[model samples]
Target: MRGRSRGSGSFPPAINTKAWFIAAILAIGFSDSRSAMSIWKSAHGGVFSMAIRANGEFFQPPVQPICAQPTMWLAALSHPIVCLVRKLELLVALLVFVMAACFFIEMSIVKPPSKEVIRGLFVPSLSGPGATGDTIALLGALVMPHNLFLHSALVLSRNTPSSVKGIKDACRFFLFESGIALFVALTINICIVSVSGIICKNSAVVYGVALLACGTSSTITGTYAGQYVMQGFLDINVKQWLRNLMTRSIAIVPSLVVAIIGGSSGAGRLIIMASMILSFELPFALIPLLKFSSSSNKMGENKNSIYIIGFSWILGFIVIGINIYFLSSKLVGWILHNSLPIYANVLICIIVVPLMLLYISAVIYLTFRKDTVKFASRGELQMILSFELPFALIPLLKFSSSSNKMGENKNSIYIIGFSWILGFIVIGINIYFLSSKLVGWILHNSLPIYANVLICIIVVPLMLLYISAVIYLTFRKDTVKFASRGELQMILSFELPFALIPLLKFSSSSNKMGENKNSIYIIGFSWILGFIVIGINIYFLSSKLVGWILHNSLPIYANVLICIIVVPLMLLYISAVIYLTFRKDTVKFASRGELQMILSFELPFALIPLLKFSSSSNKMGENKNSIYIIGFSWILGFIVIGINIYFLSSKLVGWILHNSLPIYANVLICIIVVPLMLLYISAVIYLTFRKDTVKFASRGELQVPETDKSKVANDSDNVEHKDQLV
Candidate 1:
């Protein structure tokens, strides 16, 4: 046989090395020659051109081949790599199965789960004290933030047909694939939990070994997830190694710290904490996914069916509700049981409670707030992921429901009705969760008579406030519409006396309101109306107070004490009203700016007393003013007070500079005013930081009758009485 000869003086070993590397990479990525050829051609500018011929001879044309493959040995070596690459998912799945089998074998050799384990896996029960937390952890682990993104992306990666029937078939196949995978995972998890329960001592090592394998394998998946998320949201490409390195680096620091400080137990606790975090983050991922899948705009003809959308939302809300319950229970327990001093507790409550309220508000906003940025680009998906995860779902729901957007794909009436029912269920769950916690706290705490009295007083008012809030949320037309124009005018008419007296007094006094004030006729009418209103208010206050005092049975000395105190206060109040009504204006017609400046200074005087009373636990009980009401009230109060102080200081400084006051006089004024200001500030701070002292009676506690000792008995009757009281 004639042997083909190489034209070159020597075959470059570098060429062989390069060829081998190229062949190996191709083999790792593609199993079939068709795929390999396509990729190779793309890389080599149109053809899989090689420097050497099939017979180990150089081409006669002297044209430089895109790639140099000098021999067949390198190409043949890549075949096994190709096969491995093609079966990568299958290989991983097999490895997992093997590890699971090994764990099962270990369990059989040692201690194994009882038959009851199977029942436990299927039937949910929170038997023990830690069961709730354990259930939450399981939920968190089952529905992880990374896993949510991973699963969706994995499903989308399948090569499916564009036609309706083909698409349906593809979906069915994928669903089957997902169901099988999840079943396997669930089985493995159940086995692990059971095994751990059986052999609590040595199971740590065994579980750890298995977990290490699982985690190590998941690193590749995690890397891919990160890559997909980054590309989807940011439209950026990163090298696999670099992406893996970044994620590993971030995770390693925390792991190292926990390992160093807490060791293995701490590491385990860290896992629990991570699960909780994932639970909290679940809503952010879930809402968007449900929204997008249901939305006809995003999914087109292949949008999620009505039943699927309804089921998904209901499930999502259930998860969210559980997370919220877990959070609130833990927080309240911590607050109640903390070893901090009462004052410190009060301070923290004042700060942290408002923050918690804000957090809740933010969650609500995320749920309902419309998306401003339309996710039109791949990079914008990241924006949705970051800021508007919950809101991203809103558009989906909107589009899916709207005939204009979805056309034939719009949700049907049955689907809509079911969705609304699910929505109602979510709302009901939230209310029940909150109310149940409140009721439990009330029933659990054994309190003194005084505290019980306070609780009773507070509870009624709080219930009213709660009802008001619900009514406002349900029926209020617009957020900014506090009152209708007619309602406002009627309110002003009712409150006219309180405003009119001051206005008329200032206008006529000439020292406050401008010189060109109200005309005599207007002044006369204003004074008459103001004085009449004042008389009615004074009469009402006196009658109510006196009647209350007289009707109650009291000692002669006590009655005397009440009258002595009340008579003087009534006189002073009457005298003040008279003086305000008669006072004359000092200045000419004051401009609108001057009026505003005056009102700004006066606002704090009204607000401070109002807030002091409203936020007072003595007056409002444990269900005191809501955090928003209290915060907004205090903020407005402070701003007004600050303005008044600034104006007062500026005027005092100006008077001292221009009026030729002695140094001593100025110092004396400062001494008096500064102390008063300091006292005012101190009073506000004290009020703000004061803790509610009212406590409610516990489940079995009953108030004892003062008169009849024979009738009072601590028995089932007492329990019945307690129930009646609640």
Candidate 2:
């Protein structure tokens, strides 16, 4: 009985044996084929030859070695392994198709399970760590940002049920369908991990070569598929083609370089970097979600349950808190080390000080920013574009839970409650994992060995406790009350509309968020709150950049370093502010020429957000922002642009000023307060001319849209008649 409970008898012999056989065959084949394939491929033309030939290209040039001779054997071995992976990938593709079909079946034929089964699914259990983690990730991934938009639109794919019972049933079916698809995906992931861990453990050379080939091939395949799919769906042509080529090149170059330089070390660094990046990226999604989901004004009576709103807030905070810690620790460490020259340090402080004040002011605005008693049309449009569109939840959660839209089926109460809890728990785990690394990095640098060890001992248990909480939430079985259509839509209405604003406002070309979005203000507040948390990181990055510059043996190199490190950063902030101030409403595309230019410049930047939002796959749905957000997000886009430009310009400017050809320095006002002067004038204009668009009210008060549509309906008819007469 004890052994059975321990899962000794839980394994079905049929599946167990099949799994082992598969693993064994994969392992055997991997070792045998590697050496032969590497030798053959290298002697011929290496992997590229095979790729080009596969594409029906005539191979011409004497095949050149793609890898060093030493690495050639390893590369050749990767070929058959590549074939195996491709075959397995095809199988996975087939599985995805099957899953899609099952989803359709659930939607069209099978009835949703009873509430009892729903309860069984939601309540946490020891079930197995593998199962538990898979379930959590499956659910997490299912809530994709794009799907929010897609699901909302897709629910309109067919006539929806209006009856409450019918709607409830449909919701149940949608949830069931999604659940099954997620489960299958989880199974595939587990299988891959299990297989790979067993097969590739000892052969570092084989592992590296195979992984690189697999990753590159998969990327290329995906790109080809994506381009082909887009071409089929849209009428984009050669000019856009060039744009795509450029964008792909820019994105791929850095990644490729990183891979080459870091090798396997790069992969680990990339993972850590990605985690921090994700943490930073979360707020961009979370704040908008929390604001939109919780708003009574946007959603009306269908607003999120207090419990949901509260839980989401806590989860968002935890994630944000962790990210802030990582950021701050790095910063503080830099400060303590004083890696930069005294002059350079002063320059940075001078630049950062005002911006810090501005950031604080912006936070005050966010905390106190009142929604207008009436909705402004332009603002509404902007808010929707900026906030609602980016997060992907507005449409997804609405349609998924809507009884009127779905009918006699919605996520059972257990599913709804458990899903939210599960999402939070997953987020919490990520936070814990990241926070531990950040803390460990800081202590290792600063603390005595014994003290650091003691700290780890204390911190480790707290982390475990956090993990336990997540586990508890996962296994807690309870029945869930399905939300009504109104409730679901309310969540959508509020979230989708409001979510757009922060992204839009912050990114806006115009400083419409006023002083709210300035880098200084934002950075300052983040720095202050995040000091103890991210001090180490800030310190580390700054120190590295500075130390590299100062310690160079060559005077020319040191000068170049200062130029690279110091000047560009300052210019980036200045440029960000300038870009924001000068931003225009390029919303309306008057011509195809106009559209192409906009897409070319904008699409690359837009890819960043899209990659982030969609990477998780399940976090968003169709509601994910369209390429249109790129046009609108030009304002916030300045942050990245400013950083790049400033980094470049500062050094160049300093160099030019310092090493002048005598003529330019005399001609230009090197010490003039031109930017400050311009800023003062602009501030005056903003203060004098800025419209008070926002109006705060008591909670539950409704805002009216700018124009009553019914009133304009007759006027539109009259205009049409007049046009006909003319």
Candidate 3:
């Protein structure tokens, strides 16, 4: 009894089985696949607003003038304002669903006749040509594949007995509970469908409320399901609100873009298209699940019986058959009827033919693939989850780059660029996650924040130092680090010119992607993203430098000296960049590595002065360093010194011993370079020990032209849309 109580055996057969989760991950956990499948759920937010507007119009009194912004409408109903847009919609959606659920529960019990209920439950009819397609959407909506992961996760919450009889009993009770849940869901769905079918135009509020509830609930639940999938498959537990925000933001952009372009009709089309995609994506999830369920080696005593397996496979085959039939018919009809250029149609055929074959082959392979993992111990799982230094980065770089392995399916240029950007995002997220964990550990030890900061002062940069080395090596020719989506700005500004500018001279060829070359729309979007990044970075960089010069307390002579150095240097680089960007012919940003080395030398030039000024009370006034920050500043100073010493020592020793340049020549090289190196070290040391010598301006002594002040304020925010570039 104690043993049974101790083991919450509900999930032991599923969650505890490594074979199950691993197989599931392979089926649906790839970044692109999961995101694609999630779009249908995301389309609802736009439709929710549409529904609100429609309902708002229906309830409007003849006396009240119409508002252009439907979202901002104040409906005549004073109490429950029909369409509460903005922040209140989510709460409104919740209320709508609750009220609808109660109404439906009572209706299902009292209104619907038993005969009609049973017939509707038991029988499905192909009433028309569109009926078959609607059925597919129905199946997709009802049998959401991601829910399998969510269910397994949820079952872990229950404390079920571990004993054989107890396990069986627990399964039966869970099954009954699930049935009850399904019945309630079905009742709600049935009533909603019926109401829509009836088309009660007089009661637009009813339908609008229904839509609001649906779009809000679908997105909310989908985001949660994604959260669980990430937790279960990848063991990634992102904060819930953050995860929701990310998902909704992703949804909003495409939806809003479509709405703006094509209006209500376009949004409706998008929703339908998303639904179709969701329907087709089901087999990818279902086949693998079916494969796992039928295997006694994986599921043990819980494996599906022969009868159940036979029935399930037949159902699976039917769904796949319907998909294939409809897809082939649609493609064939489009191919025959479309009035595009012959070459374009041929291009479409070339792309579509192989994809169709690949899809068919994949379904067959997933069905037949053997399940090798029956169990995994804790250490094995841990090792698999947290990859070591080179293992994670190296293999990805190699495999993606290897022509022999990927062949024609080689990574797209944009994909390669995006991967490099995402690598930095992953690094930033991991740093934050680990730092938070470190803080918790310090808190337990009683001296939390200061000690944590002190430890970060040592540990974080060391981690960055080595992690950066791997990143530097892994992404040599094309490295972009993203902060927001636009941080791919760096990629476009630098690496993009390398990727795209050279192509202007060459005849456009499809050899690389072959029929999968960028469409005109994609090419246009890429150009836009590229230009926005370039223009914004250029604008911001110049503004920042100007601000630094104008705002600083550096001596007038020093400021003049900086302008002398910066003006020509900026022109030289900017001219070179423009030449590279617009030139018809190009080389592969020749000696990119040497360029990196040259830029590395410039790092201390920026950091030393910035640190020296930021740490000084006179320089920054109230913004000057606190003790915690002062300690961090010293640590940075030490690190910089250590780096400089090692760099100089390594070069000096190599030049003296390794390079057998004639002895006199070697001596001459060292004599010439060593003094400049010493000067650099002397400057660093001087900055490290320097006291604040500059005086702060008196309260009213500052002088600025009124017009110039407004210009600065306006210029600062002129490119606010490009905040992501920062």
**Candidate 1 per-residue C-alpha lDDT over 379-414 given as tens digits, one digit per residue, 9 for 90 to 100:** 657543433222333344455666655668899988
Top lDDT model = 3
Per-candidate RMSD vs. true structure? 36.4, 34.8, 32.5
Give residue 410's lDDT in candidate 2 (0 to 100).
72
On TM-score, who's better, 1 or 3? 3
The lowest-lDDT stretch of 10 consecutive residues in candidate 3 is 1-10
lDDT of 2: 0.43
Question: What stretches of model 1 exceed 4 Å from their correct place?
Answer: 1-88, 110-113, 200-208, 346-359, 369-726
> Rank order by TM-score, top first?
3, 1, 2
Q: How big is the positional error of residue 139 in model 3, measured in Å on the Cα after superposition?
A: 1.4
> What overall lDDT, based on C-alpha atoms, would model 3 receive against the true structure?
0.57
Give the best candidate by TM-score: 3
lDDT of 3 by residue, 1-726 (tens): 111111122134433344334333322332212232222222222323322243222222221122111211211211123422223435534644563764465344335455665676678667766666666666655556655444454555556666776566666676675676556556666775454333333343344444444544444345545666555444557765566555544555554455556554555556555555666766766775566667666556876789978998999999888878878887888899999999999999999989988878867766776555556667868644543534476568657865556667888888877876776666566666666776677667766678778987998797777567666667655333225436655545645545554453232324434455677777667667666765675676689789999999999999999999988876775686577666653333335566676666666777778877787776677888787987897787678667767877798887689875898998898899889888977877776677767788855668888998999888778765223121
Global lDDT of each candidate: 0.56, 0.43, 0.57
lDDT ranking, best first:
3, 1, 2
